[model samples]
Target: MQIRDLPYADPGVPDVRSGTRFLLWLGRQQLGGQVKCLLWGLLHHLGIAGLPLGVGLAVQAVVDRDGGRLALAGVLLLALGAAIAAGDVMLHRTAVTNWITAAARVQQLLSRKTAELGSVLTRRVAAGEVVAVSTGDVERIGWFVEALSRFAAAAVTLVVICVGLVVYQPALGVVVAAGIPVLALAVLPLLPHAARRADVQREKAGKATELASDTVAGLRVLRGIGGEELFLGRYRAASQEVRRAAVHSARMWALIAAIQVVLPGLLLIAVVAYGTKLALDGRIEVGELVTVYSAVALTHHALRNFEEIAQAFSFSRPSAKRAARVLSLTRTTTTVPKPREVEAGGDLYDPLTGLRAPAGLFTAVVCGDPDVAGRLADRLGGHPTEPDADHTSVLLGGVPLDELPLEDARTVVLVQDKEPVLLSGTLRELLDVPTSGKVRAEHALAAAQCDDVLDALAQASVATGGDPMLTRITERGRSLSGGQRQRLALARSLFADPEVLVLDEPTSAVDAHTEAAVATWIAELRRTRTTVVLTSSPLVLDRAHCVVLVHEGQAVAVGSHRGLLATEPRYRAVVTRETDEELATADGRAVELDALEGESA
Candidate 1:
């Protein structure tokens, strides 16, 4: 594919079993490009091989004083030179196209995987390793892919030259031909050591990159805690280790390069010394000796190509393996057959936890442990805790959620976790998420209590002379306060207005007053739709139509805020966290009020 046509129509499935298979798969994907590269490379190298024959013929014609033959040889030399120049230009163009296309394909695969896995991707792979694979590892893979065609052409050209040498002068040709294999294979013994060093260097570099990324991401927290110098020192140590590993890797490669040069030079010397003896003894003509000598020099160039192929393979193998590892990660959940569209606003139920959010109700789940609450929230949205957790399914409107297509499932239930990400973009761009369009941006923002955030953004925009909606947000909204970012994310989720909304600790980052306001507005806003909030906050829980108290991974009690306070001790402790006297007063008041109202009736 051309650079402009990128983001391929389909980045076909790859073979991820091994690095070698992945590289071969890439070759097959860009077969046409590879073929063109090989053809042009062959033409270029063949043209260079022809030069010696032209010069040899010219020398013979000159010695015989045949002007006509000399002129013919001159024409042949000119044609070969022109062919070499043309082939060189085209070969370079095709090779570059191959390189860019390969890298683009790998990048596309990485991007698709990232989108599919979402936050779970970082849990499975290190953030730094992903970055390294997408950037440097991709280039290494492309380099090896593009180098393959040239290596093939070089091998073919070497063989042709050897055969011609043998036909022209057998004794010297045999010596040169035999030496060529030794020269090419001389560096094989050092490759294992070189590759091991390269792997070490790559590992160190990934760690250093990950360290830098983590440090930058948490720079604000570090500075607040007076730990900036500690992190900086750690990063310095990682950088130094990376440098040491790189130096060791480079030393091994440098030794291989020296061998590459020395072995070819020795082969050339052997050819020349042996050819000279043949010429002096009248066993070979002067022109033939010159021809053999030129061929040997050209053969050295071919041998260098062999060394480059070996080096490229050594470096790219690990990169390709890393890429394959990422590509091989398929979703563990079984993909069910697609069904017709189902109605929205269904009752969400998780069989594993036996927690149910009835249709069009505001249900609050209070768990003693936050992690258990989070897991329940995930299951409520048809997101299985494990890939093999299909047997435990969440049902929507009596249909097993795992049976629904991913997109349909998302439309039915949207889960907003505690730490939702806000991508860098304008305010409008951020709010322009996939939605049912029932809730307007203004209404959603107001419901999420983001008026202050909007006012801040508007003032900043005014100072910068831009529209409030067009105000640019920094990465992850880092420039905004924690509460501001949280509110913005909540606003975005509210704007989606899905059939079922599962919010996990949505108001944890806000103050009590703001939390109360958000709790009130959210109930009012989602009154017509099903909403499940996983929280232990009294304000949010009190506002829910019903509260389910989850204890030890199971829903132990379900009732209203007042009823739960009077009945379930666990629920009261989770929501109020009060002392014995305070708990007695609250529970007595709730029970006495209920009894007094009952007596009046």
Candidate 2:
């Protein structure tokens, strides 16, 4: 396949048995690219090796005063130079191609695995590890793969040049050949230490990255709870640890590099001194002495490849291990999916919680604990639930929801998570998914009260022919406000228009007016579909056809919002958080504070 056709239509199932196996699997997948790289690299190095021979021949031709031979030497030099240049260019191009395509293939595989695991991935793998795998680890793995082919080429070039030298001049050739092994093996002792230090550095870096992300995600909460400094201190300490580990790792690698340099220089000096004595004593010709010197000098380049490949493996091995570990994550919190379709038009029932949403109706679930509500929502959609509990799978039309094929189950029910992500793309790209063709994008945007968001997006970027859908958004919608991002996510979910829609606190981030508008539109939009909303907002609950109150992990009450409020004391206190007098007193305090601020102004 062409390099442009990379990231294969199917990346194929990866072998996540172990890190080394995974790396080998990646290499096997790109065998064709690797071969091209190896071929071009060998040609490039061979061409380079030929240059020293041509120079030696030219020197000999000049010494002999043979005009025709001298001219032949010049022509050979020109031809070899040209070959070297062309080979170098093609070699680099192919190697980089292999690197990029391999990385892309791994990225595609990670994305596919993530899509399969969903929430189960986060539960099983650390956030930092995933970040490291998706970002730095991918590059490291590709680097190793790219280096492998070049290293092979360098090794072959060194051997071929040594053999040629030996046939031309046995005495010097043997000396140079003997030293090549020493230069290659001199740094072997330091490799284990360097690898260990690098692994430590990588581990420290991953931890720091995870800590930084967590701090940023909850910066507001941290400040509110007066723990910002605590987290900042922790991140700072983690950063310091990473820095120290990196410095120590660099020192070890630098020592190996010094050894590579000093040993090769020593070998070159010995070869040159010995060759000079041979030339002066009439044991070898001037040109032969020069050839021997240049050949030994050239072997230094090949020797460096050994070190390069060794270091590449040291770094990439751990990276591959982390990536493989992430890919190995299974849905331990849920049962395996069955390869069958879920029957349509069935009640969404969670047996563990004894909560049932009748077919083709808007059902609202209220749980004081957001965690409980979230778990319930996940159970409704056949997602990971409490790992400690052996929760029975939710049922859809009398069939286990988790038993259906992944696509079939997802087609039947889409759970709009509490914090739906907005990947960077044009608005159209974000909303354009495998939809049911019932609800249009425009209608979804309108229903979600995203008109302001659209206008803001258009005004933010008019370059897309003034089309809001064509407007560009930054990653995670960082440029937009929380409510705006939330609305856009809701619009995307609505556009899918699944047979059964389960939204967990969909409108929580929105303003009261927007929430009220969205709640009303949602009731109208999915009036005929089996829609379940987990929310405690009075605005959303009042609009539901039925509201189920969950307490201590079970459905304790089921009725209309008004009826439950009027009759259920526990539900009323949990939802309202205050009695009538206390609520009035809180309002009075808010008014008094406002008046005091007005007087101060």
Candidate 3:
């Protein structure tokens, strides 16, 4: 594969059963590249292996004072050099390509899975683990994947070099051949300890990353609660643990490196010593002794490849396991995809809670428990947050949402999640998503009271000549205030203008005035559209045409806001928990919320 086609259109379903299997799957994906590397590597090592023979021929030719033999030796050296250069260049080229392609494939798979799972991915897998995989693990996996081919070629080259030596000068060739193989095998026993140390280092590093991620995510909350230093100290300790584990792992690898170096040097010395004695005793010629010494030195290069292979695998094994663990997380699917569609203007019914909101009605659902309301919002949109497979699909217009295709279900019933994310992009891009196109951008912004946010962003984008629509928002809208972010998210959701919109505490972060304005505008803009708002706010309840009081995961009562306050004691307890003033009559309650108006059908 070329660099331009780096990211595959479809990375294909990976075998995420285990880390080793995932690694094998990656290897299988790029078989052509691996074979190319192996062939190139074989050619390269063969050229290096031929060097001792060329040198020995030259020495013998000079000793015999033969011009023709000297010329032949010169020609052999030239051919060997060419082979080495060509093989080295192509081998490096193919190995790097394999590394980059493998990394890109892994990144693509992770990206697709993340998108498929959405925010629930973070809930299922640790954010730290995901970050580590994306940032560090991809490189490690690519590294070992590329190393395998070169290691295989080196192994084959070692065998060929040994056979050639034994055939050229049997006595000294046997010693050189046996010594090289022994040196290659010397580092194998140290590998298991190195791998164990590396695993410990990886585990500690993952925990440190997790702690750091958590600390940064909650920095604002920690500051508010005067707990910043507490988290900071914990992270510092975690990072120190990571450092200690890394150092320990490093020592083990250093020992392995020493063994690889020392063992090969000792083998080379033994070959030279034994070859010199044989040459002196006239058992082997001087030219033959030189060739044996040179050939044994060349084998050190081949032996190094074995050590490299061991090190690469030791580091990458744990990384592969981590990546596999992250990808193995599967969400419980409540909906089985079926090619179906639901008609507009259908009542939303959650069978488990016995809650039903009438069609085309602006309804407010007040739950005493905020957590229950969040889950109920998910259920309304065929996205269940709970682990219970016992949940039946919430029906829209007498049709089970589970039967409809996910796209169809989401298109018809939109859920403006409790924490709506604003990805970093221009304001226009943020609002540019699949929509019914019934609501204009300006209208959605006005209804959600986003004029202040627009004004600020426009001012900030002075380089763009004061165009707020072209202004770039930071990730998660971090640059904006919490209330502004909430409002902008609401505006975007409103712009989509789905058939049935379900919003969970959309105005919870806003001030009383802004919340009241948003509640009023939302009701007016969504008129004749099926809308459900889960809120305990009286301002939002005042404008809602129908209000349902949910207590302990059940729909206890349903009525107008003022009627519920007047007759339903349980509803009043939930809604007025913050402000427990008793409104004696319906007229009094209406007077209290005189500024807010109900939706004009």
Please tell me which predicted candidate would have the highest TM-score against the true structure. 1
Q: What is the C-alpha RMSD of each candidate to the true structure, in Å?
A: 3.7, 8.1, 5.8
What lDDT score goes with residue 281 in model 2? 91
Per-residue alpha-carbon lDDT of candidate 1 for residues 1-601, written as tens digits (9 for 90 to 100) = 6777887999989999998899999999999888898899989999999888888888888888989988999999999999999989999999999999999999999988876655556757888889999999999999999999989888888888888888888998898779877877889999999999988888888899999888888899999999999999999999999999989999998998898888778888888888888889998887787788888887766677887888888889999999999887643255655564656766788777788889999999999888777767767776554653436677888888767766677677788888888999899999988998889999999998988888888888965575678899999899899999999999999999989999999999999999999999999999999999999998998899989988997788988988998778778777777767887787788899999999999
List the lowest-lDDT window of 10 residues for candidate 1: 330-339
Query: Local distance difference test, per candidate?
Result: 0.86, 0.86, 0.86
| Model 3 lowest lDDT segment of ten | 578-587
Model 3 accuracy (lDDT, Cα)? 0.86
| lDDT score at residue 108, model 1, on the 0-100 scale | 92
The 10-residue segment of model 2 with minimum total lDDT is 330-339
What residue runs in model 2 are displaced by over 4 Å at the alpha carbon? 61-72, 118-131, 211-241, 273-285, 330-338, 351-354, 385-392, 424-430, 440-446, 449-481, 510-517, 549-573, 576-601
- The CA-based lDDT of model 1 is what? 0.86
Pairs with backbone N, CA or C atoms under 3 Å apart (clashes), candidate 2: none
* Cα error of candidate 1 at position 11, Å: 0.6
The residue-level lDDT of candidate 2 at 495 comes to 89
Off by over 4 Å in 1: 335-341, 385-391, 463-466, 578-601
Tens digit per residue, CA lDDT, model 3, 1-601? 8667867988888888888899989999999999999999999999998998899999999999999999999999999999999999999999999999999999998987786556667767888999999989999999989998999999999999888888988887787677776778877888899899999989999888988887887677788999988988898898899899999989988887888788778877887888778888889888888887888778877777898888889888999998888777643356465557788888999887888988888999999888899888877877666656565778988988878765677688888877888999999999998999788999999999998998999899988999999999988888898889899999998999998999999999999999999999988999979899999999999999999998887898989999998878778878887334453464466765664544332
